[model samples]
Target chain A: MFHRSPIQSFARHGMLVLLCVLAVFPLYWMLNSSLKNESEIFTSSIFPHKPVFSNYTYAFTQMPIVRMAFNSFAVSIMMTMLQLATSLLAAYALVRWRFRGKGVIFAILSLTWLIPFQSIMIPNYVLVNDLGLNDTLLGIVLPFSVSTFAILSLYQSFQSFPGVLIEAAQIDGMSDWSILTRLIIPNTRSTIASLGILQFINAWNEYLWPMLIAKSMNHAPLQIGLRLFVNSDTNMWGSLMAATTVSCVPILLIYLILRRQIVDSFVRFGIK
Target chain B: MSQSLDNTIAPSLSGGTIIVRRRLSKKKLRRFKPYLYLLPAVALLSIWMYRPLLYTFYLAFQKWSMVPGTSPVFVGFDNFEHLFHNKSFIDSIGNTIFYTVGLLPFSILIPMILAVVTDRMESKSKNFYRAMFFIPMILAPVSVSAIWRWLFHPSNGLVNYLLVKLHLIKEPIAYFSDPGFAKWIILLITGWKMIGFSTIMFSAALTSINREYYEAASQDGAGSFRQFVHITIPLLSPMIIFMLTMSILFSSQWTFAYIDMLTTGGPYGSSTNIYYEMYRFAFSSLNAGLSSAAALLFFVVFGLIALGLNMVSRKFAFYDN
Candidate 1:
């Protein structure tokens, strides 16, 4: 299989290796910078002479780093739960039911995906304020909880699920809710897992919506917290990098744990 | 509540009414069952999603900030009419297109090449390279931006240090701060972050292609490059078009967070795109009317561009299994 002509293979492999390095070196630089002192960071060096833990510790104490992480976790987890429940139900109804306006409703919902959040930022701000949800965690969690992409993707999966399962459940005296919980949810595990991870990642990376709605440390997530660190601009590169690394850890961990599922989710959701 | 009682009461009195009641009950069970299943989603999306959308439209025609007592005054199309003549809005359109133009090719082409090459590698090596490239795509954009910001730092940044060390430049070059280079730098960083995603997408698309076609091409004396151009490129067009459309749609928003973090479209708003301009108009200036109008304008223009691209790409995209 490795039978390409030597010259062609060399150029191909050479270019591939070059692109990989280009992609990964910045991450290496960040990890290295997080471990280096200011003087060491300025100097040209491959490795830090003395790795320090001060920056990591400073990132924690100086800002509301822990609080921000907690907020991100709480809101992301809640939003994910809400999303999973809502998306699963909506997908099931959309997949199984022959409602009068189902097609039109699905089309309308999908059209909302094209309406970027920028267009609605001010209106959302006003709505959030009007609903008395502004400056609160609920404010951030609520808008993000119902994702159009998630519903549609899950609907795709649910559409493919055999309908006999639900029919059998109904024959066995099962309510629609029980039929959904007992039948559809169990069968679509992989799709659910992938869509869940996709939604989780999007919610975690969200910046503008959270920034607009959430105020103070009481509700700000990791992205906003990281923004504060950078903007604080104490010329404190070490602390900034450390905070960034900290914020990245959970998602990176999730990405590693479910690498294949995450990749599939990206393609499934058309995120890539 | 009383309407429901009236509905129940009217159908229960006559023989035809009893038949209607049975039919209605069955129909209600079917229709209401789906609604029950969809209740949580419909309620949440209505209040949280659709309400914001409608409210945004409402605010587009009114001048109101977050102030408590101030009443919103409807300003008709003045905000939008104002944006038509506004230089920043026009400049933002140019800058957004500039950013997308700068980022779209690198995002699509480089990754296409990488995936093509990686597909030719040994399975073990392919897995290695895929994992390495995908590591960044999995990380948060905030982390990616922070990493690139440090890497692109003018004096102490590793980029300049490497360039000078390689004897390419005699002095440290300002990357983000320079007005001329800032937008490009932002685009480059955005493209870099996106490269892994596109590469993986292409790789997945590549893996789906049968090996027999390539083997046949090779048997027919096609060179690797020719095989790539004829076989791989044509085959991979759908993924390419999909990525291209998405990248164009999101180029401004993709860099929005980073721009907010690093530059805020600084040095005379050289890096400001429509997305950032919308944020600045709303939050920074507290001008909700102008922001909403700008947002509307950006949507109409961008939506048309996306629709046009979608139409063009439909011709070239292969739907082959």
Candidate 2:
């Protein structure tokens, strides 16, 4: 609030409103198309002439939309938990202990983050294949069981935790495990939760890895399943829209509910 | 107690004699506790990331067709030599450069402007605007592609209808397959998804800028624009540069799914980047050596860029605090 004018306000909000429409137009289009029939979908209409639920029904019943969505949800949950557990424990140790090679460990982890996962795609696929884990959810989640980014972000958060409280817990004859559970983790719950949500969303939105792993439609996550649908012989636009809409609902809902925490999490950990 | 026990043996030389004390060994278990906690993360990274990385490097030199029970033959730099002459590989590198440079405006410039313009809005309005912009960033890439695919559909898409109604063009363009438009469309979609992410980054950076600087600038007769140049630009330069680097590095990756969905590197390999081209080499062509060679090339080029960026950004960062 150093300066202001009514003209500036109008111009600012007007621009925002315009950009807002542009940002949301495609999603609005997807929803609108989902409500249209086969002939209606082929027409040049902004609004559906005859809205129908058959597209959604066909997507669910004829296709394995539910199974795919459930698969995504389950895999994301497993991935999030595994990543958080490993990252949290490691971050706590790295932060609380004065260990040899601490700086080396930190530098190495960040380096791993910089190396593009694409480079390892072939080897990871080979490893998973050789292990006979292909076409399984475990295969999809196995390679990414630890996230360097998560560990780094948690390290930063855990660094800011007050040392006196930790010392007090130690003086009270508490083990390191007890001190973590009783003092540090409870105090850092919000950070953990926000990071967990991020990891969860990342896992849910993962496309390339799951697509590579799930060699068939039966084992595919929502994104892979969506791809298979598009690649299928039938060019069912309405049902494709419906399937996409269904696939997006969980993430969209998570975004809707935890908007503030999500934004804060991104701010805390730079968007990758 | 350990110190007292040592003091009893030889008061003058206790410090040197305590070096051989076995009693201190009792705490050895606690010293390894940290490593115990770090085991899972370190082990997992070693197996999944570092091991595969070394394997990719090794595989780059070996010629193999991925056949079961077959051995790969060491072909030296033949894969790289072949890549140099290969038309698709050459085109993909050019497109990779195209995507990296193409995303700067969306990832940095536009977001910087949006954040500065709306920096002073009331809380309700600010959250409303932020929420709207962030919609695309959170959507799955496949979902985003599906939505864009519908909008740009040649026959029944809104873009075509809008173009005709406005008389911008007489006929609808098959934007994805047309060589003229495919790469540009991929760039556009990637930038669209990316704008919101960088906008939030800019907004957070802006809020962290101390309010006193703006007030001081105004007191000294600087207008809003002048304040932005003198104070805001200096403070935000680090973030801007960081974002610019990130976009340049990862923009092609962001466009990958869209390319796979819309173009499949087609109308005759017009839109394919290195990642897709490599994927094609690995799976479709089943040529592991060529694919690994390409992957190795990507890793080295980007790794050097990242190291260079770390030094440059560190030197340029203007921390107000």
Candidate 3:
């Protein structure tokens, strides 16, 4: 708590500034490099002497980044909605009911969290291909629709909701649907929001699965498109920077707009 | 809705038996309602997760070329035998360990120090620095690999340019192409992306420590450094150990994208980890059996570690004064 000495404070600020530069430099590089032309990119200059908008136009016209971004959005949005729906139903069932096999079910669900997606990835790929779903957004979205992470997080919060309120609503002959919508979801709004944001971000940033699942740029997300762009044209660093920057906009915008919720979600899930 | 269904169920039933049967069926359905709610998640998990998990185990012992209409032939322990002698598999196992250990300093030690250094700062500036450090963690790995690749470009990149300009090296080396530097580059890229997440986690954990502990430490005539050494470290041990365990478990995984994107485990598998190796065996080589065997081995090993982590976290869950 003490930066009592003026010299100590200066050194501390100095180190912090350097670390900040290291942190922010790559991103700043991406932005500035996108503005540089092909010949200018090879130069060691930090900024372009004559900046151009051609790279951005090239990103849109020369590549399928727009389609890829649309695909990424659709998959992430569907994945988020599906995860939320399944998690809400499952969490409510786990918390509100006195049922048989609850412990076994919970154990089974939590065990899925232990198995990383990579271990099961090969089979999912083969299965998706066999089902003729490869290169379809559905293949990418289906396997991850129900997340134990979401269910478990919601289960914890749902357990905290007043049981007396639930019971009162039930006694008034309200159905479970109305009770969940009226009584539960409204009360635990922030938890649901944090979970939704976490899920959306995860789905948006997914790389390996989509790479394995989708064969073309039509259904593959922006990350995959960027990879394809890089692999195809090795000398197009300027255009590649433009494409990467384009892919980054949605998540960056999400982080900027919902900073607190997104930060909290990362903190909460990163430890787990 | 319930009242209408009830009336429809027994409107013409004057006999007690018919009414009782209708009511009994309704009660049974009510009891079964929880399963209905749970069906979607349970079914999907079983299909995608549990089924594939069992299939991976089964496939581990089988020989399959993934040729159309050809079934997997059970060849007991052959895949495992091949795995034991496979050089890349063995190399990747070692690399995985190296990554887990190499990343420890970047993931835990540095972030802990950063979190501590910034812990007592004014909140506004604290958050700004935190956000700056956290920016990379939010970027896609493909983007990260692209950025780092440009910076480390062999002939005309910033890193080479800077090193040459500073007289570190005369020749611009191909970092990703050279075996010695390939894995290290992967490690650096992975660690660079990872620092933000760890810093944020450490900062979050620091915020949870009751400042009363620090006050109590100071009341005993302890200075700032002494308070950190005595109170802060001890209080933060749970989170520290938790992160340590996580880094060990996930370091190889966190670097997966970078390796796949930049090196492709290239220069004779110099930069490959088990995850990438498994990927290569399945996708490139089309040897599903080999990949499945590798995954089964990891599943067992990591499964045990996860169980231990859970028990350990539960043990340390209580952090109150």
The TM-score obtained by chain A of candidate 3 when compared with the true chain A: 0.94
TM-score of each: 0.92, 0.95, 0.94
Interface RMSD of each: 1.9, 1.3, 1.3
Best DockQ among the predictions, by candidate number: 2
TM-score of 2: 0.95
Q: Which regions of candidate 3 fall more than 4 Å away from where they truly are?
A: B1-20, B311-318
- Lowest summed lDDT window (length 10), candidate 3 chain B: B1-10
Q: In candidate 3 chain A, where is summed lDDT lowest over 10 consecutive residues?
A: A263-272
Candidate 3 lDDT, B33-63, residue by residue in tens: 9999999999999999999999988999999
Model 1 error, position B127 (Å):
2.1
As for candidate 3, its clashing pairs are: none
lDDT of 1 by residue, B114-186 (tens): 8877887778888777777877776777778888888888878888988999999999988777888888888
Q: Which lDDT tens digits does candidate 1 get at residues A1-272?
A: 44768998788778778878987887777778888886786776778899998889888887788888899988888888888888888888888778777877777776675688887677667777888998788888877777777788888888778878778888899977777787778877888888878778878888888878876765689888787667676478887888888888888788778877887777666672
Error of 1 at B75 (Å): 2.5
Runs off by more than 4 Å, candidate 1: B1-26
Report the CA-based lDDT of candidate 3 relative to the real structure: 0.87
Give the DockQ-based CAPRI class for model 2.
Answer: medium
Cα deviation of A73, candidate 1, in Å: 0.9
Candidate 2 residue spans exceeding 4 A from truth: A1-3, B1-25
